[model samples]
Target: MNLLVRRLFWISFAVCGTVSLVWGHDVGEGDLKVTVLAKSSDAWDDKPLPHYPTGQPEITVLKIIIPEGKKTPLHFHSVINAAVLLKGEVDVHMPAGETKKLKAGESLIEVVDKAHWGENVGQGDAEFLVFYAGEKGEKITHVLHGDETPEAVLQEANR
Candidate 1:
């Protein structure tokens, strides 16, 4: 009986492992549609997208949290990004001197070669889930440090 139980346990483990491998989480098709604007752009002159990618694809899941009165500074992702705001309000500043407000449950598809800055515009912290698609080895963001630029800030963070 002890040997039989051990064998059954091993079988169950193997089955579970196989199932997990075979059934990877499916990225929703609707999610892909959100970033169509960025993905469809022909000019990818941003820091991360020096050249259009043409091979293996990569997906990055980004969870950004901005504390009250804190800002995300100015930056952009290397690949096209589709994002959904989870909490609070965030103001996105375009390089062209335009600002747009995004609230919880709202989504955005940023265009390629665009520079931007983000700030928490609400009284509380704001959170967001961002999905990006690009090549494996690309720089995701460029920091504009000049005060004159619309999205100027110190030290750029790239992922």
Candidate 2:
């Protein structure tokens, strides 16, 4: 009985020592960590996020790359959308003269139903991952005509 007890104690000690050695070993030179870049209770405009449209939800993800000195046409999202800047920099401009700049590794909760455009202002190409949340069969983006403004589009949508 004493022999058996001694053997069991040594076995337990060996197992625990092995575990501790493995756990304490440095896997890499630097400490791995996660950081939250952006968090918001409301959209960028400080307004509550728009409600999801009825019917089956259709979610879309897009990786867009804009070359330096390029700009998108004035457009609005009919659905809730957001984007994360993957590389370079971009400036989001609204018709009301508001502007927001985003750099690499940053995120933005895009303004919904508002006419705006994005421009790549950096020397390198700008890349972003954008997500759209909408209902099936709904149009996600609407490009504005030459004479149309955001307010006009909003009014027309309400009518």
Query: What is the clash tally of candidate 1?
Result: 1
**Candidate 2, which segments miss by more than 4 Å at Cα?**
1-34, 150-159
Clashing pairs in 2: none
In order, what lDDT does every prediction score? 0.59, 0.75
lDDT of 2 by residue, 1-159 (tens): 454345334433432334444445566534543344555546677777766655666667789999999999999888877788999999999877888998998889888888889999998999998877666887788899998876687688778
* Best-matching candidate per TM-score: 2
For residues 1-159, write the lDDT of model 1, one tens digit per residue.
454345434433432334443334465523222222123223322323234356455556778899988887666555665677889998888767777788887766655556677889887889987766666766555555555332232123321
Model 1 score (lDDT): 0.59
